[model samples]
Target chain A: MLETLPLSLDAVRDVAKECFDDGWRLVTMSANQIDDAHFDVIYHYDKDLTMKHYRLTVPKETVVPSISPVYFAALLVENEIRDQFGICFSDIVLDFGGALYLEEEVRAMPFCKVSVAQKQS
Target chain B: MARTILPFGPQHPVLPEPLHLKLTIENETVVEALPTLGYVHRGLEKLCEIRDFNQMIQIVERVCGICSCLHALCYCEGVEQIMGVEVPRRAKYLRTIWGELHRMHSHLLWLGLFADAFGFESLFMQFWRIRERIMDIMEATCGNRVVVSVNVIGGVRRDLSPEQCQWIEEQLAISEKELKQLSDTILSDYTVKKRTVGVGVLTKEQAYQLGAAGPTLRGSGWAQDVRQTGYAAFGELGFEPIVEYGCDSYARSAVRFRETLQSIDLVRLAIARMPAGETAADVAGAMEDDTPKPVSAGERRDIMQAYNRDKRHRFVTAPPPNLDLPAGHVAAKVKGKPDGEAVTRVEQPRGELLYYIKGNGSKNMERVRIRTPTFANIPPLLAMLPGCELADVPVIVLSIDPCISCTER
Candidate 1:
């Protein structure tokens, strides 16, 4: 099991800055739907093959601060989460605007377990 | 000069897969590059919800053809770790052998494609020709060339015999000799160096900052290879991550070139030290029809012709006649459904392939997030592309060994 430090939506950037200052390479972020109303966005970091994880349990309606400003590598993965989970992120460096993998006409989160109607609400 | 947006690929002649980049160019030099993905996004991560955990092995293998064995190995290792299953010693060595063979072939294929990208047709053919020997070894040993589905939940489904090991060593000897013959052309030739040496340079800082993996990172003087993490038999095999300090396309190609020979040596080491034991745990069955049918003269000629005509010809050899376990026995015996999470990382030919698996104590897994090496290398590719010439774009892109199928998956 992955042992992750829990973070609120507001603490994502501060924790990411700490990781950057400590010479951690941003490996990748994995986002999975915890429930109909919450998504667990896990930020994985690595330095010298040792990994440290920070997970933010984000509510569906909340807009999480993007960590791409601290680590430029986080932009692509953050955009990917937005495309797959219907979660919004603010101030991504290269914001694909949720079009990284989804077409504008396709108004569905293909990765979500809940119904599209329920997610939009 | 007015800036122009030159769209490169989605269907460019140089790209082996569809990856479009909108390059902002001013007077033949790229000022900026913005990539556009999603031409082939299949949403394979979503399949974990529908397919059972056992069935997802085959699906994950399809994520990338060149490094398919590593994909299966990574997924199986994750599932096994989650279930707390200890894979057998021999099975670990077997996985290492097959995984390195996949790396060898994948590197050779990329070298051939990189040659083709720069218009070196004969050099391209030469690399592919050498790669065919590895393919033949795979076909004879594991029944398929590209997607050799030998990995199971707890261990491997296939075991190498003494005779097969000897034959593989002989084949590797020939490939190594031929590869050394072409090293001058690949590494020091005037034309090859003219195009590759200083093109698309990425410093160690840029590579690490932008999250490069495998040869891309190593090419930039960072010896970061997940294989050093000691997955499978790598810890026992005396492995070292190959590093080249050129920080250019040449360095990346050189890293892969040197790694091909290293993989051959690693396979030899694994075969010599492989312990004799059951290939898989909890496997119980008898030998059933483990014979190879004799091919007639006409069929042999036709097979040879098709194989020579096109490398992608599906060489329809008989399936490997190993492991005669009952259909449902292997799955049923591995204990209950997985209830924990596992973060598995394997060094693929392209780079580090990561899998984040979470199970909900059900048949289907809750989440299987694959962070492919190509996916991590894209940001580095973007960093390298901005200062290169339009003519050098293909070389710079292929230097990263982009696998669009794996990236999109």
Candidate 2:
């Protein structure tokens, strides 16, 4: 079962901290492209067997605060989102600076539709 | 002491897949390790935009050759949920049977690899020999040794005959006996213990915080399993999660070793309780006069209309009459494309695999994200790598059973 909670960019850190303090395990984080300019960042957390999904929508250039301080495992997926979607997170503990999975030669934000469209055009 | 940077594998003898780790070592002790990936990345998730939902199953199954069935199963279940298709009970049972068989074969293969990692060549050969029997059973039942494509949306694609089931039972019994002897050797052998027992320790807290799953979490004494969520037929089979408190490589190996036997038991239980019915619901046909009628043009047109309208409709397609689907088994089909999002999680052989799929009421999917077990396991592996001797790197790495294909896919 999943419970989706709407969150703002500012409240994400506090809410994530609360979840972490509540002994919730960080499952993974995903960045889904909603449109050309808007993206939805989902933070998945699990406690016992129930999954809680916190979702916040941000513009393409918005800098989402890093949740790595609350959940260390967040660094990997956060870096991945940065690499694949060009979503930026501030103050990541192990920041790869958008070089986590892709190489330097590969074009950035391969999963973002806008970026792919721009490259194709 | 000067720090030496050791580049471990875009190619390595012990690693079956390509994983490059930049290990900074001081006097043979790894002080820091950084992993660089993408050597085997096929961009499979991105392929979802081009492939329709049906074709995505074939691509997802190839995510990891070892956990192929679980990937297809997870993808199907997610799509089925989105379409709200009720699979037949017998199909669920068959899925459980094949799933456990896959787990058994995967663990046996890992045992062989783990033994080889520690230089136990004889043990490695013995484990692989036992694994071959399981492979033969897979080939005999599913028509392929690896990447068996038995799972489809709403239900499975094939059924096992009574004779085939009995033959599988016999083969499992023989393999179990051989595995019992091998387990004794593994536990008692000093070399195996020396290499695995206290190396790469991960406490329960660390395991949970690191998002470790499957035998890795179980080895650290956590009983969390996605199977506990009762997906597929595991809920009906009285599934129990095997766990160990050692929090070390040996504990992880023992967890996997015991799970192979547990999986065999699961298969036996599934066969004994196998229901008498059809393996799939007709996805594009209707029953008339106690006979399945071909999908009418009107119905097909209605389905197309529904697709254009962005409405969900169920359809049925009957399997070939001569196949194993028992008489009176009806198929439940989805008439149009899925237009919603679903999150499906399945416990693969390695760990908990999650698939996030979003459909847009068209033939093609909008987005698909696969969180493979190995991908989740990488952070924990990095945590384990540091503070260990350079020589123990391969053993510790293999202890997690990193599947680069799954990770990069």
* Reproduced native contacts, each prediction: 0.80, 0.53
lDDT by residue (B293-330, candidate 2, tens digit) is 35457654655533355456554774323325333423
> Who wins the DockQ comparison?
1
TM-score of chain A of 1: 0.92
Write candidate 1's Cα lDDT for B1-409 as tens digits. Answer: 8999999989998887999999999999999999999998998889898787888999999999999999999999898887777889988999999999999999999999999999999999999999999999998778799999989888887777787888889989999999999898999999999999999999999999888999999999998899988999999988899999999999999999999999999999999999997778752222233233454577546555333566686858965434333233222245567777788899999998989999887777899999999999999999998878999999999999999999989
True-contact fraction for model 2? 0.53
Clashing pairs in 1: none
Q: What is the C-alpha RMSD of each candidate to the true structure, in Å?
A: 7.7, 8.9
Candidate 2: residue A41 lDDT (0-100): 86
Worst 10-residue lDDT window for candidate 2 chain B reads: B284-293
Q: A10-41, model 2: which lDDT tens digit per residue?
A: 99899988987889988888778999899988
Predictions' DockQ, in order: 0.78, 0.52
> lDDT by residue for model 1 over A1-121, one digit each (tens)?
6788888877899988988898899999998888888889888899998888888897776778888998888889988888898777889999988789988777777888885421221
Error of 2 at B94 (Å): 0.9
